[model samples]
Each structure stands twice: as C-alpha cells, then as structure tokens.
Target: MATNQNFIGGFQVNRHLLIAGAALTGAGALIGLTGTVIVGAALASAGRGWVRQLDTPPSELATRKLHQARAASLAGLEAWRTGTDGSPN
Candidate 1:
C-alpha cells in the first residue's frame, strides 16, 4: 500500500514571501532614516539664520556699516557727477 509522508496538512511555507517582506521592511527603514537626516540638515540651516538674526549687537553694527558705506558711495557719485570730467573729488 502507498503512504503519504508529508505533514502539516501538506502545506508548505513560501520562502519568497518571507524574503520579500524582509527586503521591503529594510527599504522602509532606510527611507525613514534618510528623511530624518534631510530634515535635521534643513533645521540646522534655519536655526543658524535665526541665531544670526537674534544677535542684535552684531546685526546693528552690520547695518550701521552698510548704511555708512552706501552714504559714502552716494557722496562719491555726486562729487563725480558735478565735476568737470569724471575725476573724483
């Protein structure tokens, strides 16, 4: 008489499914890590800008220097415009 040797209702577990699930989970974790790194870099850049803006003394000094430079340039331009030839006063 012939006899069956297979057990567990003759149902075999698919190895492909297990491998595919692991690969998908690893890919998702890598994507999540990459997204976190990108967000951290962006936040650092924005935080630097915020800190620079918050430093009132340095910002004021820079603004004063810029205004002085602009005024000097305007004065030089006026002097050149009123001169006989384009020679600087």
Candidate 2:
C-alpha cells in the first residue's frame, strides 16, 4: 500500500534491537537464565515500540517537530528522495 511507503522514519534502530533481543532470548533460554530472558524481552518490547512509532499512521514521534532545523532538513531529504521541490512535505 502507498501508506506503507509514506510512513517511514526508523530505518535500522528497530531492526538491530529486535535481532539482539531474539538472540539474547534464545541464548537465555538455553542457559536457563531468567534475568537474561527479562532483559531480552525488554529489548524486544522496545523494538516493537519503535516499530509502532515509525510505521503507524501519522508516522511521527512526540518530538518530531521539536526542532525546526531538523524538521526542515528531514523534509528536504524526503523531498529529494521523492523527487519533489520540497513543497511543504
């Protein structure tokens, strides 16, 4: 869907987190370490949260508009990526 393509922000943060969590979770299970499992679960939860924030509708975090320069830069980058003239993207 076009919505999927439009709502983009996080590129790698969520993925590395998820991979680390899954690996840790499996290792913890093999080693019978409850604490390791807890940490891994926490990381996985954080990764999923990141996914929800990045991929959901309105695709923006609470602080997305906090910095004018950063926002403008991101808008510019998106405009270039989409091959536009940066018309209020």
Best by TM-score: 1
Model 1 lDDT at residue 64: 97
TM-score per prediction, in order, is 0.48, 0.27
| Error in Å for residue 67 of model 2 | 32
Structure candidate 2, residue pairs in collision: none
lDDT per residue for candidate 1 within 30-86, as digits (tens), equals 999999999999999998898777857677889999999999899888978877455
Q: What is the C-alpha lDDT of each candidate?
A: 0.81, 0.71
Candidate 2 lDDT by residue in tens digits, 1-89: 32222235643345556678999999978788877788999999998887777654343543565576688888989989989973674
lDDT of 1: 0.81
Clashing pairs in 1: none
Model 1 has how many clashing residue pairs?
0
